[model samples]
Target: MKKQLFISIAAFGILLSTGCTKLNETVLDESSAGGLTDKQAAESMIVPVYATLPNLFTHTNYFALNEISTDEAILPYRGGTDWGDNGIYIAMHTHNYTSTDPNLRNTWNLIFQGISRSLTAITTLPGINDASAKTFLAEARAMRAYYSMLTLDMFGLIFVKEDPTALSEIKRGSEAYDYILNEFLAAEPDLSSDVTHGRMSKQAVWGLLARLYLNAAVYKNLYAGQFTFAGEDMDKVIEYCDKVINSGRYELSPEYFAIFNDNNDTNKEIVFAVDQRADLNGHNRMAYFSLSGDQFPLPEFVGANGTDGPAITPDYYRTWENAYAPEDPKVDPRFYKENLSIYSNANDTCVPAANFYINRGILRGQQYGLIRRNGVFLKCANGNMLVGKLFHDTRNRPTLPVDFTEKVDFSVEGSNYPSGYRVEKYEFSRKSASGRNFGEANIVIVRLADIYLMRAEAKLRKSGDAAGALADVNLVRASRTARTPAPPALSNMDLDLLFRERGFELYWEMLRRSDMIRFGKYEGTWTEKTDANPQKRIFPIPQTAIDAASNLPGYLVQNPGY
Candidate 1:
């Protein structure tokens, strides 16, 4: 396994200021000029490109921009004090963010860091004449394309940098769309056919192409009142999705939660993922981000607790409830998975098992966990664990129950630690039993189920083939046969139903914002957000980036309505 790459801030600043120039050889930890072979040098150049993914997808950065800004999640102040980072979370949920928002700025910098590192590899890897170097070059190009696509999606612009010493030509609108599409197309053929875990592969490129084409209409005209999904674009989406589906290399996991489990590195559903194997700079924040501080999943590590971050919005929860009305949504295998087997009763207490698992899916109502007293976990008379109803333990509200309410208030005073329903989609890392950063669960970027949904959406959009779309949606719903009474196949399919189905399968996965925009539902009011401005569809260019490029006037302009 490759060790995590560490680049210093000064070195990164030089690369950024120099317009994505080739890094100093010593920056890659070279002791001597001729110390490494061609293949080793090429590998070294590419590692940093992949290293940027974990930070880019950190819960507070890109994930926040994608989910919190949409109806899927919300992060509010706890007791009008905690998480009140100058109202940034509230501004993001309510669509009042500016270029100066810290989350936006961090996401912008992380995306460009990936882009810059890819450029360094693309420019420097060619020096190695070995055949293996060619494959690395293709992967570098694909990484650059992926970062560029994110740039277009978030900031409505792409930086086209070819010469390391020269200024980057900024592309926007159709120009940016074509550039990103061509980059992926150019790199697809040379990508390794064999699955390389964290690295980009041929199937990963197919998945990325399908995603790009599905959102082509939006990228072509970002600020449009309503995006016009073209038949050709939808055809491209179906074409690429068919390539992945027909390859016989991937499948839907029977246990829905297993797809996000700590041992999911080998799971067939994942196409492209940020490999967070042991020893890499993996973070467990995704697992504990939405969890209440009082609810500790791992008994061995009492110190490893939740930060009481974002929670699922009631509007999103209602979608699940309304879909399976009369029957509880939890009955659907994808909706919820109860993993705490030992603590079955409200007054249950037993020796905490080493393999304790937390409940997955939309968490609601009262929560139960190991009791902590006087900064120590309580134990039974037989030295077993004592499990009971939890209370607020971190935010100076110990008397308040840790019951997650469905409806969350937008105002600071109205919001509390347990205001909204929490989601535990990803499993907590056993390796990081003592901290939040040593997780080992791969952050899935593309997966087979999402491919099926993309194909289903394309089929519905292209010709309104309800049967074709229904078959695809049912395939995903029915594949989760591990739980009793799998999600029943729907007899009907439409745009509205397809949109809701996507949410059912792919919520809290950082796809909600783009999904809402593509389905023409972004401007609709949901929970605290009431802004209908189309210009808010894409975020503004970070003011810091704009100022850095001030020397070159008109080089980096902010998106409209900043």
Candidate 2:
């Protein structure tokens, strides 16, 4: 894993900085001095690949990919919210957004790195003689399928160079979908069915295929306008979903929060995740990115140095609570967790909760009646910590067992201050991490919860079998929550209901954008945003991509609305 990590990053740096002209025809770099003969050495390279998967799901990235893509969600317009203007640009192009930025290039590069590393493995893994070599390469191909799905989903193209020999002739555009599809189908047999969470298995491959075909209409279209799912594709979607279900390796975790509560990496629902391994002696993690205290957390989760980033919007929370069918009692338990601070910055005080929380607010606000021993609560007039969960980020850490709560405060005063809610889904770990770096986190990419929802969509579309879809959807809903009036009915019976259910179930998980697009809602209206154009469905091919292939003339024209 370590070798995989080093090679993936090193190769990525080389690919990003060097254009195609200076670099070899192919973008893979296997020159890593790491010996691949032994399992120990071979696994190092795999580590980087897995390690980097989490990078694409960070606040900075997910915001661009998820929330910004949906009208059901929005950026706070706060002074520092990133507001994800890049996604807004596409949203605006769709007529749902008006903001803009050039830095979305960063997102472009990060995903591309995933692509490059997968390519490197696909091209190089076959040369090894180890008994497990084929298994590893199959994993590599699965990664390629994963990223290629992203590329096809986002850019409508593939790099098309699995083999070093096919390097020079590689092309991009909607034309690349065929190759991407073939790659995934080819690799499915090699994946295992052992039911590993966050590890690509045969079931996961099926999920990818399900997702791809579900959106086949959009990918294969000549002009993207109100794209609709085709019958054949929808059938395939159902086929694959059933394959995943019949495998019997995974089932929805009874508790949504438990899936990510701590050590969620083992959850049966998780098909893939970022292995946030922290270096105890080196850099403190999960704490650095999500922690608030500057005194502990490797002394990095404080002051201007910390990310102190994005929070759940009040509007989004409302959607979760209101989107349910009222007749069904079980909704997502995570919904209640949506906008609260699950970790104390450093002072150990509970984080705040409110429509727009800033800091040190209440754990449950006035909504649930839960609170701290001090009778601390949300101030409605001030919107301070009125709707939140204040736990301790430093409750665990390997380095010093240091109390991150002692070093900071979790309260806020104004502006975009949580809008009264902090996302507790990725809580600060009590122990820093594997190596005590405080950077460790349990990643939840394709959890069982997600598969349930994906299958619901497929089944619903396949036969207007919202009854079947409703069952699957409600299964997830029933697992996570308890509610007043017996919760809501599983309305997978209605397309609109099913669509909204997805947004409510998958909020902030990086799947929202694609889900919205699949449901034909990407260009829909949000609280304060809207997509204006059709071409914006897919992102503008990064400007750098054009320059790299500019010599080929018409080789890489940008997607419209650039």
Name the top lDDT candidate.
1
Q: lDDT tens digits, residues 111-168, model 2?
A: 7787666667665556545555566677778777787777777766666664655543
Stretches of model 1 off by over 4 angstroms after superposition: 1-34, 342-344, 412-414
Which portions of model 2 miss their true places by more than 4 Å? 1-41, 77-103, 163-174, 277-308, 311-315, 324-332, 337-422, 433-439, 481-488
* TM accuracy, model 1: 0.93
lDDT scores of the candidates, listed in order: 0.82, 0.52
Q: What overall lDDT, based on C-alpha atoms, would model 1 receive against the true structure?
A: 0.82
Q: What is the C-alpha RMSD of each candidate to the true structure, in Å?
A: 4.4, 9.8
> Model 2 scores what on Cα lDDT?
0.52
Candidate 1: count the clashes: 1
Residue pairs in collision within model 1:
350-385
For all candidates, the clash counts are: 1, 83
Candidate 1: tens digits of C-alpha lDDT, residues 1-562: 1111223222443332221112212224333223455555565666677778877778889899999999998888877777889989989988899989999999999898899888877877776656777888999999999999999998888989888777789898899999999999999889887854577889999999999999999999987877788999999999999999998899899999999988788899999988776655466478888888888777777776777889888889999899888888998988899876543554455645574667898888888877777788887787767777789866667889998888786665447787888898988888763655456788889999999999999999899989999999999999999988889989999999999999999998999999999999999898888999989889888899989988987777778898
Candidate 1 Cα deviation (angstroms), residue 434:
2.6
